[model samples]
Target: MTEFDRRKFPPPEDEAMLPWYRGIFDCGFISLHPFFVIEGLDPRLNEHGTLVLEGKDRPAGADFIKWMDQLSAEHSKGKELHGRSVDHMAKRFGQMIGWGEMCERLGLEDHCELDAALRTHIKGLRDDLTDPEAADRMVRHCAANRIFLPVEGDIPPLFEAKLAAMFRRAGFTEIIAGDEFGDDECIVPVIGLDNEKPWITRDDFPTYGHLRLMAPDHSMLAWVHWDSFYTAIFATKERAASLDLDTTFEGFWCAEETKTFWLTQRPLPLVQPR
Candidate 1:
């Protein structure tokens, strides 16, 4: 087995500060939407799941959460969508990018604000589905939910090419024409960030750092896990000095605390000693 599968890959350094990027069912997935985590000296901020929006470019993700809540209340019986096998929901919401459901909820039938794009995508799926041998492609592209970023560093012929090839094998297209960490246009991964200095969400969450998680040695890798991607950021004193480097939000990666947030999944805590 591979090292990570065998639990041999070194655990990431900063369990707190690093932006955890993964499926909706990941542990470090808890963060206020629209927040971003940047690290190192890369000419491009492009990565799989790396959000490329400023503040308002996000398509009302909070509204999406509200809609998901509504869907859960009427459809899901208080059970989170983590590992629960629901074919119908997966097909309807997971496939068509929630366009159908959004339409249904808004009473927009099959045509509305952005139904054209949705319909085009859906038609492609139908075409693939009816054709034999298309099911495999369908399954992989439809249900794979795999990582889709070709992270190619411009360092050398060894590390950079190796990682770039690896991600490409996993289905990511390298679009880097220059010295940028170019990859697919962050297809499945979505992003949000905290812009207002005093990120006051008014909920259980007290405060947020550019780097969400931290360690006692300040040596943790500048990234965290969600379910599918790895995200990094700056830090806060509480988050920075407390083992996660002396970098605080006062200078870089500063953001307000998200008040209303929950992981909605089983969190596998990183039980590292301080």
Candidate 2:
């Protein structure tokens, strides 16, 4: 068998232990789903977890060219082009397909290019994690809205361990290991949003959406976020669908309502023995 056959999809144990609604910060619910397998050999994964398909995956690149050719046929007039222009195509592709696809079409398929891209991307994530202003902004947004960021590789191991210690110091009861999901991180369940109420709105957030969290009376929302990257909030599969959140979080979403707020209480809640 090839690389595809050797790697386990969700790994049998994870499939058994992780509940359907227990979503992680990586790969959306795609890994959890039974239908599709993770593309193991795809050369798009970088140090920072960004997937730059250009020059990385031949199949995806070929498909991109085929699509462009089809677009030309559909929009171009017989001898003289009437409908689609280069500028129009550029805008449309940028908006609809994305920059990665454009790169693939333009024959910029250099897998090594991801090195620089990862450096820049990871730096931005690091800034958000370290800078007080950026951290404040992230916490406030997460608090006010039920939004979570998905950061892949920008976190350092020491920082993650420190964050875990902080979580324990701050009074979170359980810190679960996230090894099965392919990362050096721990998961601290914020709240469980059961199907009954089915939501953890901004109001439900304990510390204005910062790192602080509470274990709800029920365990519906398997809330999680990457400790390395402090800017995102993770939702369980069940809650992710309810909130209409993009689980994979291919890129950061800019919130139009950019504002700031404060929190006095501890971010995560303390668990009292039942």
* lDDT against true structure, model 1: 0.24
Residue 191 error, candidate 2, Å:
18
Best candidate, TM-score = 2
Please name the candidate that would achieve the greatest lDDT relative to the true structure: 2
**lDDT score, candidate 2:** 0.27
Worst 10 residues of 1 by lDDT: 176-185
In model 2, where do residues sit more than 4 Å from their true spots? Answer: 1-48, 55-156, 175-230, 233-256, 259-274
Question: Across residues 1-274, which tens digit of lDDT does each residue of candidate 1 receive?
Answer: 2223101011343332223222111121111111111222121211222222223533575575565556445543443332212222222222122323333433433322222222222232234223333323322342333211211111111112222332233333422111011111112110111212111231222223221212222222222222211232232323323322111111112122211111211222222111
Candidate 1 — which residues are off by over 4 angstroms?
Answer: 1-68, 74-211, 225-228, 231-274
lDDT of 2 at 151: 37
- Could you tell me every candidate's TM-score relative to the true structure? 0.18, 0.21
Q: After superposition, how far is residue 223 of candidate 2 from its true place, in Å?
A: 7.3
Deviation in Å, model 2, residue 232 alpha carbon: 3.9
